[model samples]
Target: MTAVSQMKCACDSCLCIVSPNEQAVQKDGKYYCSDACASGHSNGEGCGHTGCDCN
Candidate 1:
């Protein structure tokens, strides 16, 4: 079987694809691209990646 490497960020509004073996943030059994996404953007912050307006 092929090992999973990359997947979309867990945040509903996020458009980023992250590598599970890299810096992807793991939260509640889901993978996110940033801490902001992991926390559901409660502080109204974006993921800091350009072109992604998730907050």
Candidate 2:
């Protein structure tokens, strides 16, 4: 298989793709597309991404 260089955001409800070459956020050994997701909330209470309600 091809070498994997990117991955989906670690947030359970997030749909963002993360790449080591971008500004993706890193937390607890997982990668997130933003600080909110990395902090466990894409927004203040949940993943701010549209349609995602991860908390």
Candidate 3:
């Protein structure tokens, strides 16, 4: 099978795309764009990527 090189952040509201094997934050088998998203934004933080407002 072909490997996945990129995908949308697993966060429900995130707009950033990430490589699952690269700079992605893995949580419960899902790939997120940042630590904030990986933690469910419990700290009122966002991924901080340009154009993404997920928090």
Candidate 4:
């Protein structure tokens, strides 16, 4: 699927804000400020859906 560049946080992690130009190509359309945050969630490091990064 295409990347989502302008969506708000609806996931468990809502602390970090989504940048205007930043985007994440997640299966569930999850949005994060950076890859590190997304990766963290996937590894169960931070707050997010299960397997969040791989979405």
Question: Global lDDT of each model?
Answer: 0.96, 0.75, 0.92, 0.50
**Candidate 2 residue spans exceeding 4 A from truth:** 1-3, 42-55
Highest TM-score, which number? 1
Rank the candidate models, highest lDDT first.
1, 3, 2, 4
* TM-score head-to-head 1 vs 2, winner: 1
Model 1 alpha-carbon drift over 4 Å, by segment: none
State, as a TM-score between 0 and 1, how close model 1 is to the true structure.
Answer: 0.95
lDDT of 4 by residue, 1-55 (tens): 9764566554454554454454553434565555545564565455444444422
lDDT tens readout by residue for model 1, 1-55: 9988999999999999999899999999999999999999999999999999998
Candidate 3 wrong stretches, greater than 4 Å: none
lDDT of 2 by residue, 1-55 (tens): 8765899988887777778567778788888877878887635676566766666
Root-mean-square deviation of every model: 0.6, 3.0, 0.7, 8.3
Q: Which residue pairs in candidate 3 have backbone atoms (N, alpha carbon, C) closer than 3 angstroms, thus clashing?
A: none
Using lDDT, give the best candidate's number: 1
TM-score of every prediction relative to native: 0.95, 0.66, 0.93, 0.32
lDDT of 1 at 49: 100
Distance (Å) between predicted and true CA of 20, model 2? 2.2
As for lDDT, the candidate ahead, 3 or 4, is 3
List, in order, the clash count of every candidate structure.
0, 1, 0, 1
